[model samples]
Target: MASPKLTWNIALAGECMAARPFSVHDDEESMRVINLLRGADLTYAHLEMNLAHSRELEYPNRGDWLGSFMMADPAVARDLKWAGIDIMSVAHNHSLDFGPAGMLATKKHLQEAGVEAAGTGLDLEEAREPAYLETRHGRVALISTTSGNKPNEWASLGKGGYKGRPGINPLRASFNYVLTKEAAEQMKAIARELDVLRQADGSTMGTGLKDNEFSFQMPGDQSTRGSNVFTAGDHFEIQSRCHPRDLAGNLRSIDEAKKMADLVIVAHHYNIADGKRREKVPTFVREFAHAAIDAGADIYVAHGWHWTLGIEIYKGKPIIYGTGNFFAQSEFIRRVPYDSYESWGHDMDRLPTLNPADHPLHPGLDTHNEAWWTSALMGLEMKDGQFVSMTLHPVEMGRTAREGTITRQTGQGDHALTDGRPLLATGETAERALGRIQRLSKNFGTEVTIENGVGVIRF
Candidate 1:
């Protein structure tokens, strides 16, 4: 069944970020991005930063090895709402940076600021449930999940006489590291030499679960570590897959969403990249996106790559694989906690004061990556829940060649607190960004027409 609403619009943006108040900036580029976002019946954005409700609420950095603490001021939530972000997916990797309290605080602030948040809660049940938004055109239901979470970050059910862990909705993925025969043999020889191949019980274990968690890499996805030699294949490759339970859980939520609301949208944050092949999409991500469409989701968005991927039209629905940063302001995060700094081997004494540009956590600021700098703000028009047409409004995040000239908006007197605004891509800037998306979409045989300096898709 399709949404009864006819000829309604939905704007899809990836990665919502803004530390300072963005509403203060009404520059041409800002207005261009804002107009499209506000004009949609449903506006979706992936929330990657925790609202620093209070730096004192901060827990010890949980993502030290793989990430850093990223926060925008709490008031930024209101700014985002005013700037037209109706719903946010709070199931990204950074959702737990400050712990459960921080995650809930972010959700509370979003709701208080008039925004709907999905994929995070005090229990696994709530986290997996759909969040709804009612509009004049139709009612929208969002089911958000993230594959980029750690063991401690997943919401778990409480046992007998206990409470469940408050966390983000998790869609755990597995990775199988394929090793060649020669490499496997070498590892086996080393394991035999070290006398660690067999347990005291004399049973050979193929893997362990600590360091390599391709399947959580949980200890033993890769057999190279610690005197453990496993079987090897003829060729080397990396295969990515998602857990069955998590997949079933999300698909059930999608079915629930379809029944609950007129439009069903599935937003998944899957940042796991294929090690052996960085360019191609992960096996499980594709499978999950298609499965979501099959389960009655009107739109399936898989993001958090920090780079744009391909787009696929599956069963007449849109499966947007990658949406680059909607707001590229990680570099503008006010404070880089001592934990994050120390993890990168930079203590307060070694590096007294940190400039955002000098920080290494945000590579997009220092690099010239096409997907990082330029992205599209996608607008889709649907009739009775059937896709009619789509428009890609090229967005130019600052500090890149793809962005337009900035009018220079700042937060207070602090340069670090400035708004991370996206300018409208013009001329060759728009052409190149759309061209990259076109080339990527071509991988799925989806042709994008470049008309009037924007990408258009009619189905």
Candidate 2:
């Protein structure tokens, strides 16, 4: 007798916000979707929001600028468990919405649900640690990090009499804005009026700078190496790079994961688009994804902009730029902080019980936005430590009617709220959605063919 061929099936999705719990009564389409996930040897997705029972805002936090809170019901993790999610990456922008305690509670809930998560912990080292999921085929290792998180939300080291903070793993990056001469002058005046310039004593810059093109550099010991805020140019260009520590830390984790697991997946959350095209992958993301593959990642997935992006194949590996949403239940969330509403210039007293479309804070919840409702589940087949092919399963998110009934829809939906559960797309819907994916991925030099109802990538 010979050993098995060690063929493995893996499924991947992005940014699941399963605020509502599922039941046995779920529709057949939903069951089909779940079955596809359950069939995989290892299933992975980005757990977009925190999972907790309570809806209160506690702890000394500082992300009021986000203007919204994303907390899914912890019981929803049961739905993910039922859907057969093996591993998840939970280090995105909303990881600390309810503070570090909320993040920790989410980790506890996921653990209880038997879903291992990466990219968050009690300290920086732990946050950067790799999470493993053991399977009969092979052990799958996951390392997740986010490039867009609040400064205060970053996990810190407690050394030399400093106190360590609990938070998510971060792939931090900074933005430098360029502007016209007139706008630059205006920014300078505003900065001067606001006293943003650092004095001889070396103070901090203004946090409330309205102008993105204002150039302000904080003093350094031997060099002025702080982020230069802005420059005046006719046509502005922005430069972005993964932070050195974050890049090195995650790469180290990938190396370690290679030693421990048969397969490694790196999930990063970042949004870098080409102009108005939200699906365009940025240069930094491309660089980082390729580096991860070189460092030992079998698959590299990026998400967080809430739209499906392109895919690139580098060194016989797949780099999924963005998988859109596995589930987006933000519209169905019951409670949000009062400050969240206020940040959107809404009167707290006149709180409108309107739908997310009517609400300023959650315009994406509007079902009319087809991109928000369309996404795909990727299935990758690997055998004998070699790449095989990928299958794209186009899924249509469930939408809620004005009468509060759930309806399966593809493309645009009625003004009704989105239920945010994924279902397999069929008929012309599958063709259309998968066609869109083909178009999105073509620019990255990855081609796909629609076979039956799913998109196939033959190596």
Candidate 3:
């Protein structure tokens, strides 16, 4: 008997966060600090808010953060299983928001549920490993990475590199005021004394001070005596930038997996998509995607921006700028009072100029409004390794709690609260969603058409 032939169906890419409840109290200060330290405070805040709202609606309502979205909504995992999605990349910034414990839990859940997750691990060795999947047609490798100055610091699965920490290159910040002429001489004397001590230690103790230890002993003196002496006017920027070396290391792991697979898919959590205010794409995105393609990746998918952006073809490979939100189970609907216009559909507007009277459901239209947003996403796609096709599928984020009952959309638009089931766009709303995509694509030099509530963009 001969071995069976193999076939791989699909690889879906996007972002997922640990679910947190919404905070009614203002927490901008704490959030800002977290954002500065971590690259994704807004996402964490969004999770916080959504979870809070969900709890209130669920009753017995003692508030507690759900830790990870995957845990909160098993339906999402179920959907992926049903869709035949075998692997996922978890390299986004928010992957570390709930901390290492949460990340491990999420990864554990996915594995037990039979889904493969890559881009993070329990140690540097694990973080640098790739997730491999095998099918009848061929094998597939999924790899992920986060962007910014401190990717390792935010690494949830491994030992993090930070100043005064046990990881890799640590980030440290300092300031040194210029010394007076006399002060400089005094500092030089102290340095001479330290050198004498170092020599004594080398001879007697048989151990010399490490370069970094020596520098830390007299930072001010060193700064004053250096070719570029520090002054009050001098400013130093000391962000712990993610070294390409680290990225390359992770890529190497993926490459190893690639050797065992027929296709390689790389997913990153970064802002590849420019917002409405910017016309041109970012240089980093273009450069990085091209680098990955040149390094032998078949597809490069990135998401961080809340909306979909552009698609570019590099060296005959497809790079999707952003996929927007996919199955985000938001809790916005629960925050607003049911009697308000938001709950009744008071905000639906087909044209730029929205009229409350013309669009009666505008006030109550939350997820319905997002349906149009999701439809607009279909306008981004890649075909035959070129920037050729784009399409959007309007997906409601959550599963219905009960059958045959109408529910409202959450702020994240992840689920319908009534039965906790995912909702699909329908009727006039679905039609308009298709139309919106058709119209938006015009600006990008593409033509979009919709049939049966599906938007297809022709290049």
User: TM-scores of all models?
Assistant: 0.87, 0.84, 0.52
lDDT of each: 0.77, 0.76, 0.43
Model 2: residue 344 alpha-carbon error in angstroms: 3.2
Where's the lowest-lDDT run of ten residues in candidate 2? 400-409
Candidate with maximal lDDT = 1
Better of 2 and 3 by lDDT: 2
Scored against the true structure, residue 331 in model 2 reaches a CA lDDT of: 68
TM-score attained by model 3: 0.52
lDDT of 1 at 49: 82
Alpha-carbon error at 291 in model 3, in Å? Answer: 1.2
For candidate 1, write residues 21-40 as lDDT tens digits. 67887877578888888988
Name the best candidate (by TM-score).
1
lDDT of 2 by residue, 1-459 (tens): 533456788899777977778756467856888888899889998988788777434652543554447777788887788888989998988788788888898888999999999989999988999998888877889999887676778998899987788988888775566677787777778767766542233335334334334455433322343455676777667656677777888899999998888888999987444334455677677778988999989899999778777777888888898888878777666666666676666766776753334366654653455556677899998776556899999887763222223474323534445567888766655666687779988997889998888899877
Cα deviation at 316, candidate 1, in Å, is 0.4
Question: What lDDT would candidate 2 get against the real structure?
Answer: 0.76
RMSD in angstroms between candidate 2 and the native structure over all alpha carbons: 5.6
- Stretches off by above 4 angstroms in model 1 are 1-5, 195-231, 348-361, 402-419
| Candidate 3 deviation (Cα RMSD) | 15.5
